[model samples]
Target chain A: MRSNTFKTLLLGAVFLGAGAVAASAGTLDDVKAKGFVQCGVNGAGLAGFGAPDDAGNWKGLDVDACRAVAAAVFGDPSKVKYTGLSAKERFTALQSKEIDMLARNSTNTMSRDTQLGITFTGVNYYDGQGFMVKKALGVSSAKDLNGASVCVQSGTTTELNLADYFKSNGMTFNAVVFEKQEEADAAYDAGRCDAYTTDASGLYSIRLKMTNPDDSIVLPEIISKEPLGPAVRQGDDQWESIVRWSHYAMLIAEEFGVTQANVDEMKSSENPEVQRLLGVGEGVDFGTPIGLTKDWAYNIIKGVGNYGESFERNVGEGSPLKIARGLNALWTKGGLQYAPPIR
Target chain B: MTLRDKTADETPRSWVRAVLYDATIRGWVFQGLVLLALILFAVWVVHNTAANLRAANIPFGFDFLNMRAGFDISQKPIDYTLDSSHAQAFKVGLLNTIIVSVLGIILATIIGFVVGISRLSRNWLLARAATVYIETLRNVPLLLQLLFWYKAVLSVLPGPRQGYVLPFSANLSNRGLTMPRPIPGEGFEIVMWSVPVAVALAWAIARWAKNRQAATGQSFPVFRASLGIVVGLPVVLFVVLGAPLSFEIPELKGFNFAGGMVVHPELIAMLLGISLYTATFIAETVRAGILAVSTGQSEAAFSLGLRPRQTMRLIVVPQAMRVIIPPLTSQYLNLTKNSSLALAIGYPDLVAVFAGSTLNITGHAIEVIAITMAVYLALSLITAALMNWFNARVALVER
Candidate 1:
């Protein structure tokens, strides 16, 4: 398929293009020298995750993840430049150091983490593969989808999960696989498939973009775990730690009930953890290990807001997707999103 | 002769320069140097790549092909499952590529010949229509055409629930065209064997008829008789065997048709796009081949009181074929290579399934890409070899 093969050749071209290789080590230094942190994003445009807006500004949950890293690095969320990449190009681009960070709504699987010459940071969004179908189809549960035709994107865990799920459940379904999510979406919209499947969060956003969002319903059953997150190149401990904790900073900010508007006010609080996270007066300097300033977390909070705020604005109740913060809520709220102590 | 003698006599003084002045020796030395450089470059590239991969810690190996592919290919020419090894998955992909390429080549050649001849038609409408078809198809990108056929035309057809009924109770839908599977019964083998017997009988009859015409200066209706024998033998045997055949027509079960042969829309679009696009180029080649055949040959036949149709069939086409076969081989190779674009429309061809999906799941880019490139190379070489054999058959034998 040109969708993926074209990307392989494109990556090979970039790989073979003389002198295009970036410095393998010291990405932080390189990013600093260039004065902008380059982040590769989803080129197929997963809206509410990594698609650009009408003004050509990248605005999505995944986009904010990169901005959060940039704020941690440069104390300015606007200092990041974005490169839209396909599923095929994302890993190769990261390995070649073509981008400092990758926030492409990718799943963090064991094979991807260990073998692809890159390491995923903390998960920005906890997701699972789910199905969406037209409301008139009368299909309510995944168990009832015995002989359904499901449109899914190829070359991803989604495809594998679809197969495994069907086999284990003793069901048979026709899979209409496309190399790109957009193609699957079109196929589903054209009534070529009985159901369209992707990450549950993606289903929400994709449904929001459909001609009539209210006509379809996201099935309640989750089929496969999809831990969507950002990643950095392997072999760079400093850069890896910095990106890892950037995600935690957003969660910790939410755990403490802080917001972008109230971040400065919360800086003066007496709680030792909050004071330390914000680098308040006489608090511990936790950013030294990652080679960032003490106010790195503070800058992230101030620039992009906390994880909950970003979630609401980009993909949650405040946005058109209106996805519930199920597993993405803070550990205090009994969700799975738990961060390490800043101290 | 005097200058040559003087030069030969003076050669002893410049014998050191004479060795360099020998063109054959100079050419051999230069070729050897070039070969050495190429070998060295290849060695260096291999070494450098191994070292880079080692540095990156991305283990590269072919052992992973034996592992489970763990994915479903939407379309396959052969039976495949998720648990099939990557090697089997690759075989399915290769077969899919072969089927599409073979069909595309056959369809393109047929259409190309007709359109190519129509381009020279005296009728204004036919000539203009052929010109329009060639211009429009060749100018547009094949990828766009494939997408248009897939997404806009085929995929937008009625869904499975509202599928259109075709002859023999087959169904056509956005899913695909499902045809009835023929179920052969008792004595079917005997009827099947009669087909070859009929073909052999037809061949012998044609030979005898040709010899008779040559010896007696007369003609036989060899083509019609051959066609009749081939068709008549199968029917007579099948009837004598009590019509021992039935069809298992596809019927809508739940989500899709069952007990039938289904051809996915992905393959249909690929075949259509590849054949239509390549036909334009083949048509141009056919036209050039026809023009290359001398007009004097046809004129001579016409002067002998041969009809125009007979002149074209007996005299002009045979000569034109000699010119057409060589370039036509290149068009065949192009169609095969272009089939790699199958993944765009979700046709599980070689590149899409093995190189694209399998590589991604395995995370073994070096091995995957190397194998894919080698397969394409082998396929192209094989196509060229077959065409070369065909070309040799048509080549003129001279005194």
Candidate 2:
């Protein structure tokens, strides 16, 4: 009787799952037909990435990436719809086909790609784990964190990195854990912990929210590599290419000096590389490869400018984050943001 | 007449006869068809998943669990490092979940009982206050409450440099509550062993006293005598062992408390939120259970010259428990399940660590999700089984 019941239930589950799979064609086909991308973003208040303004307008580095993809495909950046997701809901939303892409400051790792059934296109920001301590502690480096209370967000790479750093150094530190970065920041600021640790980019964003930013200093140490990038659902090869090339086009456009302001004029430039990037004179057939327009790169550059321009305006030297390019600079400038040749 | 009877004795068609003559066989055939369809469907899904994973160039395996978890865990009960295996990370996460769930259960029960009793209070103000608490808390979503606690309450606390001093060498700050940690000295192990031994001795004494009272009609003062032995024996052992215990008081260092156990604010907030939210529901359950035991039972006990305390303890509570156990079991399960909200505050619970981070790190969504679901299901089943056993013991036996 038990075996029979189990078999019946198994049959029901199989039919349900199969029905769901069969009803939904590939996500790639659906995305192309829609003509605009649906991107998920961090709804939390991470300043440089996805925080809202006082007027309630969403703007950030991650947000710009989504807009750039929209520009590349639809010729209008505003055509994209941004669905805000909390950290926990972000992946599931993408997996459920609620969003076409996730442009949050998500770290690219092997486990997420293969296990979670997602694919990270390429790294846009190279970050590292670091610690921030109050000035009164007189601590300059992570080495001085002996027996210190460290406030760390739980369920993050920072948490494990913190344990490793302390244990490896043979130091015993108390952990004042929080579930969210904002809570950890609050605790750190309120003297709940001697220090706060997270990704360096996050540290900067969090530090800006401190009441006395001058009283805290981020240690000049990078622990773990956090290669944050945009990702798409797995099995969507065409959509993946479109997103990947969209980001790469931004890089190539920056390399060729195709600023948003000069994009129209740059189309008729004498330089072959500039002309090719702006969709002039037998431009590389990006439209054919990714099932978009040949001028997809042109729309991207014209709408959001190139990578350098986006960085400076959103989170670089000009922004409140005031972060240096570091590894995010162009490959020719001895950084890691290298784009494949457009050919 | 014999020839006619012989002609009429011919059997029906074989297939018709099989269906008509055997109910079990018919049932088996029907069930078999359903099973075959299910197997075919499963094969198709497996095939699609394989194809999808292959196309994406992603390997599907559990080998990732053996790899080093390069991240740090802030509130690990056991020793953990970034170099620890992913399985170790998961264990740490599970331990954190258990810690929060246990604490939340105790707190919720206390609050629940108080509110439950207050709801029945004769005083108008007290009843209204209890009603307000239940209505307000039970209505709001738990996730929002957790976020509010973390973001609004705990975050607004004073920093470590300006820590709030509580009684008995404890500090409350945004960092968390810091308390004096007990450090074991030499010969402390012997003193620790005395605690359980003393309790066991007390239990034996109580049993003996109860039997004597029943047989000889003599009161032995079991409560007072057992209490003395349980309390005194441990203290005597500690003193005899030359006070082999010390406390490491939490001191304010340059900017924060050091040299003591630090509770993380995430844990504090999550615990507070879960306990407070679940308490309201538990309060309603307790009230309903108590009310389910008719007022006549308590009145009967009172008329027999029993004190109010005895009436409640001996008569009402036992009967009320029959009404309470099932729902109480569900409340406990709810608390355990709600511990998954630890993800909101980054508590690294089982779901957050294994299902979230590990799944992300390993890309084994199917396996990770299945494991997570199975763990929760097992926990719920175990809780239900225990409650069922308790209910059976307390249930009235009808001849």
The numbered model that scores best in lDDT is 1
Q: Per-residue lDDT of B1-399 in model 2, one digit per residue for the tens?
A: 342233555556644665655779888888999999999978987776655444444565677789887665667889986678888988898888889988999999999999999999999999999999999999999988887887765557777767688997988877678899999999998887888898899899889988998899786877888889888987898898899878999887655566788787778888889999999988998899899988899889999998999899888888888888788889999999988877766566887777666654454555566677788798778878987998999876657
The sequence of per-residue lDDT tens digits that candidate 1 reaches over residues B319-380 is 88889999999999999999998878878888877886787788777678879989999999
In every candidate, how many clashes are there?
Answer: 2, 28
Give the top-scoring candidate (TM-score): 1
In candidate 1, the residue pairs with backbone N, CA or C atoms under 3 Å apart (3 or more residues apart, or in different chains) clash, namely: A1-B343, A1-B344
Q: After superposition, how far is residue B313 of candidate 2 from its true place, in Å?
A: 3.0
Q: Report the C-alpha lDDT of model 2 over A92-190, residue by residue, as the tens digit.
A: 567656688898888877657666667899988898999999887788888888878787765465666777778888977766555456656766676
Error of 2 at B362 (Å): 3.1
Q: lDDT of all the models against the reference?
A: 0.85, 0.78
Cα misplacement distance, residue B283 of candidate 1 (Å): 2.3
